[model samples]
Target chain A: MSESRGPGRRPGRRPGVSDTRGQILTAARTIFAEKGFDKATIRGIARAAGVDPALVHHYFDTKEGVFIAAMRVPFDPAVIVPLLLNGPREEMGERLVRFILTVTADPQAREPVLALIRTAVTNEQAVAMIREFMTDALLGRAAAALGIPMLRMEAAFAQMFGMLMARYILRLEPMASADPEELIALVAPAIQRYVAP
Target chain B: MSESRGPGRRPGRRPGVSDTRGQILTAARTIFAEKGFDKATIRGIARAAGVDPALVHHYFDTKEGVFIAAMRVPFDPAVIVPLLLNGPREEMGERLVRFILTVTADPQAREPVLALIRTAVTNEQAVAMIREFMTDALLGRAAAALGIPMLRMEAAFAQMFGMLMARYILRLEPMASADPEELIALVAPAIQRYVAP
Candidate 1:
């Protein structure tokens, strides 16, 4: 509380408010990693950040909203979902694979995704969040853009994410640590087949 | 302590032993399903089954032993792992996919597997059991059999299970209703590429 919370604090509430939000996110990341998505409660996060619970509420409307911020995920369909539908239909497989790989391969983009997948398996709300996000934001939007059945876009996600989970999360075996080129070469074709006429 | 204890480490003792073994297995299965693999306690299982806590010990040597029995998963790697690894290397993908789908597609087999995957995310033992089973039986063996680095094999498994989870558990859209032949066509070739020379 002694230090100005603002970017250029002159001992004011507004300056401290900014610092408080940053502290919350940093504390959230730690708690999420240590205890996992389920056990990382808002009260715990508040305590970790040395902030009032009310301040936590002010920043994040709900626990879900807090999680969305902590994850740093850009789930907006407006950004990339349209990209999925905008391209040549025949090239969808490669484009899709590339888009997923490029985005997920980034370290910054991965944590929230890993959290989503980890929690979705057991927590009903997390699972609902993932499904809803995919349908409303990414897949559904893409399906509409491409003029394909919405079901097909969803199917593509199942196929893509299934491989991702097996490789990334479970780290099953050879597949977990396969050569990227080999993976791209082999998988691109099937993906191409799926989207190509 | 009324009946003859079966031949084992503890040595000759009670007679109602056989009945208690069955009870332990029954209790273990229910407890494992309800509480997941790790949280379900041996003493708790015995108590639920209405028997002496020591009775479970008189039969199964450890919690892991009870888990194997209750899940009806084979303890030995020599059996099921080979199914995924057998046949020509080039067709490993098709062979493995066929084996998994055919073996697990039955309603009876599918129910327990769904339970295993669902719980594995939340429970340590469930994850440990699956990881050990995959490592000792399937992945490690497959790596040794095919003479590829284990890491690549691990990657392949991530892909395989990722697909399975998306397709079977979440039933993601088109994949949920995909024709068996279509899925096989799309997935097997990629698997073949990952595992083959």
Candidate 2:
């Protein structure tokens, strides 16, 4: 149970610190896949990876962090939560819309998120994993931070989520081709009502 | 090509009227998949089905109707467009939300639409086909009927589209578990802005 050794650990087989990170991620994926987001624990992941629990905390800091890293999510809540909170309450909608559109504007950045969504739609386990993660990690955190009701925040998120599908996945125009500013102007007030109301 | 016979038709092998309808649907699917919604014409589908273009029109009055039949869409725009137009303009948002949620509430009704969406997210041809059909037959028609910009209507549709994904596909709660009326209240006003503004 030591940081250096566990039942699954073999002597003289440690590649390095980076390898430890890889092993933890590998174990995290398995644990997350098997138990989903809510039930998967850092201690469990660490045990599965043959490392101590402290090392899991040391590497990822939190379960949300571990999920984000493991999933290669395009946006970080650590960065995004502050971005939403630091801005003026009135402008939060515009900021949120712009931020999402900007991040997803890049094909490379958008693909993995789209892949997750694609998986979530067809696969029940993926849905559970993603739903729990988004509810707890992203929307729950932001709703609490903004002092908004979780349902209202989710409504706003759902609107944005749909827009992303229309614009990117379905490529429905003028949504797909409209300038980001135009979308912000059209969608911001609606989002602001949920977040700031 | 005649209604009774064409190059692909075999002599003394006609099944029945229902078989012809099935043949048209099958051919429409192939034509739509190959040429997309915009390019796949009644003539093309009829030619592929080994029937007269008049027979295609007689069976399914328009390309949109054919698409709906071929795809087994849960809702029809012929019914939906009038529903949007006939209502009090201010309440169009509520009507739209209620209708969508209600129709999709049935697992039997919802699955094919979800399957199309699932196909759409990953498949370029599906996206193009759905996009054109939606833009031309559904949103475009509704927008013109209501004197709203097509872009605005599309944005509204996107909001609802995202909510459906959140509610059903992702089953994100309380979005998934919340009362339908609660969602209609939270979302209707946002939809009204784009739709009735």
| Candidate with best TM-score | 1
My TM-score estimates for the predictions, one after another, are 0.71, 0.68
DockQ of candidate 1 is: 0.36
Off by over 4 Å in 1: A1-30, A33-37, A68-75, A82-108, A147-155, A163-168, A171-187, B1-30, B47-52, B68-92, B106-108, B111-132, B146-152, B177-182
Per-model lDDT? 0.63, 0.78
Best candidate, lDDT = 2
lDDT string for model 1 (B1-197, tens) is 12322233242443364577765665666676556665778888876667677768877878777877666542234654576556666778887667666655664445445556655565554666777776777667777877876755654555556666666655566666677777676667756666774
Error of 2 at B154 (Å): 1.2
Error of 1 at A146 (Å): 3.9
DockQ of 2: 0.55
Tens-digit lDDT string for candidate 2 (B2-23): 1333336674676577678877
lDDT of 2 by residue, A56-103 (tens): 999999986786676665556787789898868889999999998988
TM-score of 1: 0.71
Worst 10 residues of 1 chain B by lDDT: B1-10
